[model samples]
Target: MTADREITRRHAGLLDRLKRPELDVDETDDEDLRHLELRRVVLEVAELDHAQEIALVRAAVARFGKAGQA
Candidate 1:
């Protein structure tokens, strides 16, 4: 398969996994859970337009930046 096709396939798989409500938390380790959560976030961000993406980044920074500075 072409690289683009492979990437699209992988993305589809990730989206399917994210949508499943039957996922057992006990079946995955903490790191796997974090990775899945991160994938979900990235997929959500990908749906936003440029302006919305910027707004999300700004909001995230406002919400979490202070904690990092401490």
Candidate 2:
């Protein structure tokens, strides 16, 4: 798979995990660490104002090209 597709897949997976009510994952696992880290980031991002969110989206799109399209 292309890198863009791979990244999209991973992002979808992370969001899926975030939506779950509870995580039964093992804390020592590297993948679980990533999930937890994403949770932390989401909590922090939740505090951003509308303009900050727009700017963040713009920057992310500039780098990842709308879901990592090349």
Candidate 3:
């Protein structure tokens, strides 16, 4: 019917848009890796303290043991 043709046309348009070749240096594209900004803000983690780190390591060992059992 006419509705089916309209749906097919819409789907085709979407497919064409997806198939279109992307620009090598696409600044507007979000996936463009060329202009990626990396920020560093180093903050000390309290959980990484000596005693807490030992506790974390023990917990990880327990979790791994349980995982191996399964």
Candidate 4:
């Protein structure tokens, strides 16, 4: 697999992990921090120069909104 593909895979996996109910809690400081970090990873992965990855990131951000935001 290529670097772009690898990044895409990682991004998708992270998205899947974020979508879990356990990760959706915003009621605690720890949960908020974890959510922020996960979102940071998502945007970082989205910065890659690939069309598919860009689209994936767009969809994710559209669905979840930007990182570091409550």
Candidate 5:
């Protein structure tokens, strides 16, 4: 595939992982590892365009903020 397609696929995969229902962001024994994973993925995704960065932030907020709902 083309480079742009690959980047788009990577972005989609990252966002899907971020929003996956099984993603445990809770404070567990592996919290450090989880943090490192998130940091690594975010840095990788941040290298993409500004629009994608914004989408990533929005998707993260939507996914993580669901716990606060009534």
Candidate 6:
């Protein structure tokens, strides 16, 4: 959603008042931001595997190899 529709976690407190708003009325701004940041870190880490062949890429990391330029 755009900035105009953004709702901070604090905004949720308003829901308990007389004018109760729709449950999950709007997307959680904090959760959305955290999700985005997490996605970015996961993607960058995946790209730094440095394996030329998919077969060589194992789930176990042997070493903390040099971090490649993002």
Q: Which candidate leads the pack in lDDT?
A: 1
Clashing pairs in 5: none
Which candidate gets the maximum TM-score versus the true structure? 3
lDDT of 2 by residue, 19-62 (tens): 55866767568665675686657856577778888999889768
Scored by CA lDDT, what does every candidate get?
Answer: 0.78, 0.76, 0.67, 0.73, 0.76, 0.56
| TM-score, per-candidate, Cα-based | 0.27, 0.26, 0.31, 0.26, 0.26, 0.20
Give the lowest summed-lDDT range of ten residues in model 2.
Answer: 61-70
Off by over 4 Å in 1: 1-47
- Per-residue alpha-carbon lDDT of model 1 for 1-70, expressed as tens digits? 6999999999998898775576566655866667677666775657777888799999988879688788
Kindly provide the TM-score of model 5 when superposed on the true structure, using C-alpha atoms: 0.26
Better model by lDDT: candidate 1 vs candidate 5 = 1
What does the lDDT read for residue 43 in candidate 5? 62
Question: Which candidate model has the greater TM-score, 1 or 5?
Answer: 1
**Residue-by-residue lDDT tens digits, candidate 3, 1-70:** 9999999999998898776685665556744452353322122323346787799889998798689788
Across 1-70, the per-residue lDDT of candidate 5 in tens digits comes to 6999999999998898775477556577576666578666776656787788799999888878576774
Instruction: Report the C-alpha displacement of residue 46, candidate 5, in angstroms.
Output: 8.6
- Give residue 1's lDDT in candidate 5 (0 to 100): 64
Q: Name the regions of candidate 5 deviating beyond 4 angstroms.
A: 1-47, 67-70
Error of 4 at 20 (Å): 5.7
RMSD (CA, Å), each prediction: 21.1, 24.6, 13.5, 26.7, 25.5, 16.5
